[model samples]
Target chain A: MSGSGPGPTAVPTARRGRRTVDLPDLVARARAGEARAVARLISLVEDASPAVREVAAALAPHTVRARVIGLTGAPGVGKSTTTTALVRAYRQAGQRVGVLAVDPSSPFSGGALLGDRVRMQDHAGDAGVYIRSMASRGHLGGLAWATPQALRVLDAAGCDVVLVETVGVGQSELEIASLADTTLVLLAPGMGDGIQAAKAGILEVADVLVVNKADRDGADQTVRDLRAMLTLGERRDGAWRPPVCRTVATRGGGEGVAALVEAIDEHRRWLDSSGERARRRVERAAREIEAIALAGLRERMGEVRGSVALGALAEAVVAGETDPFRAADVLLAQL
Target chain B: MSGSGPGPTAVPTARRGRRTVDLPDLVARARAGEARAVARLISLVEDASPAVREVAAALAPHTVRARVIGLTGAPGVGKSTTTTALVRAYRQAGQRVGVLAVDPSSPFSGGALLGDRVRMQDHAGDAGVYIRSMASRGHLGGLAWATPQALRVLDAAGCDVVLVETVGVGQSELEIASLADTTLVLLAPGMGDGIQAAKAGILEVADVLVVNKADRDGADQTVRDLRAMLTLGERRDGAWRPPVCRTVATRGGGEGVAALVEAIDEHRRWLDSSGERARRRVERAAREIEAIALAGLRERMGEVRGSVALGALAEAVVAGETDPFRAADVLLAQL
Candidate 1:
């Protein structure tokens, strides 16, 4: 309730009413590959702008074209490095690329050790590449609620490819999988005893497994451990058995990275031919729409959080005069 | 549209009046320390039954007596084992204990290796111990939505303390922290290089850090690493520093279990004396109420998901005739 409030008043402050009627031109510019337009649209989504409906409506037709790829791994697994490498590959293929570093550890904490942005500066000057860091900390609904809309903005902005990178902690990877056509789960050598992988449930979400930092000690062991795990996973035939690839993303030496690209492309082909693409799209849309609606409801509840009606209901329920269900009913009806 | 729809009809399938008028009986039974009643009420909440509001209203006054403790760790950290040990200790202290294991890894398989239940069967026969396994796999909104309701039932059921254990993957641990007065973060020796602690953001949420399986090799190193990280966290003066304790839970050994309990008690005392308890409870209630409202809104969206209005709006957005924000507005307005 501290952050969320009732109805339109709960719209993010930055999004209150900067440009409610200029959505069509913005969408037009975004579709024509305007970076500022693209950035502005993403800002609107991030801010939960009231004009978001107009923005989404205007941009929907231009979307469903970009090939969205999600890259996730444990922290310190070179996800940002791998993402930058992939962005280079896509750019080299003459495709405009967009990168959404979801939940970046600290892009906001600009300092000498700002490794993420520093390492990804290869395309800093390339007009064909757009790199954006999304902080889930302040965003309503966190990554799951915010990423899809950001992706939509990217897709509609005429990016031929969009790569989403998230740390594989908790539901972040699953959320990434739901949004990405190709999900690359990265691991590194000697990072752990492979216990985290099993615990993290990364096995279920990977379309491609990349053992990044392949030049490090125990790279083979890590790859073997992952392969053994995948085999134990016993993915039925015809299911995508995630292929394991190794890469030294730091050197940019193209060790198994091209093969990784090929794997991603093959996955794209499979998705298209098997109609999984459409299915995923529909599912993504459903989740996105549901999140938006939920966000709205949460806002309404925020307004009602400390209201007299809600407080009395809580008190009644707390005092055992009524149950929470009935109390909620009265509260909801009041809202 | 495939899953979400327009309005209240979409609330949840189980809530379509399975037993709308039997609220008072269920509430009474639950409050009177009936396990079956408690379970039934939780089932209603989980199923998003229409009677949930009544259940909440009925049970509200009898709640807030139980101290909720959250236990979480990476897989293989002996969370279930530690929880069993704690339950043994609490029972010795003559307190009713309830355990809610969120995100049981294999609730879907319904096969063996339901490790949590299997491991926690030590207290299975004790009437003083009520252990329930929550399957987040099938539950909507995962831990965020289902957990608070379950906790309420446990609290109202006269459990002096409820222990909520979640797999420390993704956002589960954070959710637990929000609900618990004290959060215990479990770790094991030789599990990883301790990088996960930083990546998982476990350092922030931990109220008590237990190095489980401390008898194993690298136990000292793990504890040292955790302590070092804690020191690096740089708590200001008067900040409660999470103390790292060692335990060999499998041995049912009393190495640091008592100290851990003391730490939990001390944390609870701090919570109460610092006014954090009231703040946390309010925040928890706010989250619970908001989740319920959002659940309702989601149900409504489900009703509208495939409806003509929703389909047309989706189509309109897809065709770029309108933007998603505007379309969502129309959808919400219709609801």
Candidate 2:
């Protein structure tokens, strides 16, 4: 497995007979900014293919370049519109953009069919843009396991910026935080979204608070409400205060969208100056590593779950023969 | 750890010096309908106290009776108000009811600050009702770990029906599905909540679709939208079709509320008659056991994370000496 020694590829006969994947070739193609190769690597991550570990290893050297931004909010918050506008803004600045929409819907589903993704087809003609949607269909470890690897694919494929868009309402929101350098929380005016945002606990993670659909009647009031709420919420000393910005994303308002990009840049600058970038990256890697470790253990546990040893232990726990903790220890020991 | 061998109580010399908790005594009090004892036990679970394993062991014999119903919706959709109304209806039938409000806002924050809990104080004088709020502040396993243990405490405390209320906007909603015998997805008209519900990916988990605040002008529209969405979403053959119901919960409308209860009872009967009850329970237990196992491993991983062994492995993986898979294998082997 060590590249320093005889690489995993050195034993060509053993590798070819087993998996038959030219991992090195794929990695080279991805590094050369081939969209198809990047997509293939992400597909492998999504599918949990056997060669994914090798892919991760191959892509490690080129993983840290792209700026990853997370966009999240409740339904109808114009996440997709904002995402599209941001893409255009970055493209105007001559940056290659990648969009990874993490669907918070059912696992049996796929793609960014959310109508917002449909609007993003404006970028489809540009080879410099790539869009992918990932669903947590059968993923037990959820976004914590899959998103990082996908981001790595885009990063190594020479994307200048990658936007991670997810519905900002669950455990996945936190996972997005780990993968992103900046997180934008979008909300629409009216419908009591300001209160909803606070209640849903997304306020704490917002690096930039965006009230999309700024032309709505209550947009100013919502912005005010958010500012007041942030004041009441605790803030760390010397921490960057999340700016409240309004944007009518559908209208392609350039200044508002550019301000958002500026906010992201400032946050990135702060992250760098405060030494939080390396800290966040290390934490993200640690989480990704732990998620992989847990996923592996779960696979082992699945095989042992209904085995005689586990069933007996479960029965013993139920029948007052043993405690669940002790039984759990026994199960882990077996693994 | 096996009760059949020598119970944890028999090792008083070993236990008394470390912790003086009397697990059997507390369990007995909880069974005798002592709210204080129940609260104490739940506090232990929330605190993740070591004695919780013993508490779980003692209470295991009494946990199967309660019918747990999970009620969730957006923040201002009157979840708390509807919950209070339902609790009153259940209390009218001479049944003991317990409420566990899973607060996504903050983990250190507890109790019913959601205003609906304040309304539920209408039943405060009634000894048959128990209300507790749980905060998911720092729990990494989120609803997967703390909730089940808390539900068990309420179940063993002689409640006939336990209402597990959570703000239904995230991964906790799915966790609630596994815990509840029936799930009610509450919506209010006028806020595009129906679309939000669908977008939140919670539509698939709804056993009962409730449009609260039906007096609002868009109440009918919301109900219609939900029905249309349900028509389009996939449904398992022979599975219960969620019925959309209207209710003005704060006014305590009897007939509408009664119909909702009837739908719940009908669903409960279907669960029993169709054996879905057993199947869901099996799946739920599997998830819980797996969560517990992962939690244990996380504790082990925490110890190993920055330690010499894990640090060395991480260095190897980052420096391209080894892939993360093999590095993870090394870490797990040490655990």
Candidate 2: stretches off by over 4 Å: A1-19, A23-48, A54-291, A298-327, B1-19, B112-120, B138-140, B192-196, B224-238, B252-255, B318-320
Per residue, candidate 1 scores C-alpha lDDT tens digits across B213-287 of 888899999999998998888877767888898997778455688888998888888887778877777666655
Worst 10 residues of 2 chain A by lDDT: A7-16
Backbone clashes in model 2: 2
Backbone collision tally, model 1: 51
lDDT of 2 by residue, A213-241 (tens): 88989999999999999999777897889
Off by over 4 Å in 1: A1-34, A104-113, A192-195, A232-238, A312-322, B1-295, B298-322, B330-335
lDDT of each: 0.72, 0.76
List interface RMSDs for the candidates, in order. 3.8, 3.8
Q: Each candidate's TM vs. the true structure? A: 0.60, 0.62
